[model samples]
Target: MSPTTKNAGGDRAGGLRGELTPRRITALAAAVIALVFVFENTKEVEIRLLIPEVTMPLWLALLAVGVVGVLCGVLLVRRRG
Candidate 1:
């Protein structure tokens, strides 16, 4: 193919490579940071609810809260979109 001719294969590859855009990079960084935070905080703590107190590893509690936050964000975005 001549340099001036558009390459369909090149275009497809570029599209795939562009998948890791800034937003994705930021999300990935956030996930890594959250993981590190959870790992660093492994001590047990008390979580008191309305009726009872539960004790678990701090990492587990943080992970659970992060999952819930992600789910809420997804639901809100879907509803708005």
Candidate 2:
């Protein structure tokens, strides 16, 4: 191999900038879709918490649930790995 083509410190030529694999692309797409789904729901919704009911924007509720789901996934992965 030519010296000009050799990577510095044995790192890839483009480093992480060239590492956008199919899995990263799919994850980006999923995040965009999830954001759209959450924002599209702008109507007010009533949520029942055992004995009390509360009203809030649907988007807020959806976003909160999404955050919780992501947190749970992260926790599970950390626990197992």
Candidate 3:
């Protein structure tokens, strides 16, 4: 009935207690990135800039893009409320 209390099976073997925190998600992402970088076995994709076209290693490009995305997200969230 209350927030602190759990009903029958609420805290069972397969309960929602195993929620993924931000730290866990970040660590998992880092591990996956490391694995991909080491393997370098991803499908090929082309990148086009304003002036020229370039071919790059997929995993390195993805990590770079992801870093940019994280920076933008942080800037947006940190803006005045």
> lDDT (CA) for every model shown?
0.87, 0.89, 0.75
Model 1 is weakest, by summed lDDT over 10 consecutive residues, at: 8-17
Q: For every model in order, what is the number of clashing pairs?
A: 0, 0, 0
Which sections of candidate 1 miss by over 4 Å? 1-18, 79-81
What local lDDT score does residue 36 receive in model 2, on the 0 to 100 scale? 100
Across residues 5-75, which tens digit of lDDT does each residue of candidate 3 receive? 98766666674458798978997998688767745746666888788888876766777777787789888
Would you estimate the TM-scores of all the predictions? Answer: 0.73, 0.74, 0.45
Off by over 4 Å in 3: 1-44, 79-81
Candidate 1 per-residue lDDT, tens place, 1-81, comes to 778786756566555465678888998999999999988999999998798999999999999999999999988888641
For candidate 1, give the lDDT of residue 27: 88
Give the candidate number with the greatest lDDT. Answer: 2
Q: Candidate 1 local accuracy as lDDT? A: 0.87
Residue-by-residue lDDT tens digits, candidate 2, 1-81: 876675555655455666789988998999999999999999999998799999999999999999999999888878541
* Candidate achieving the largest TM-score: 2
- Scored against the true structure, residue 71 in model 1 reaches a CA lDDT of 96
Checking candidate 2 for backbone clashes, the offending pairs are: none
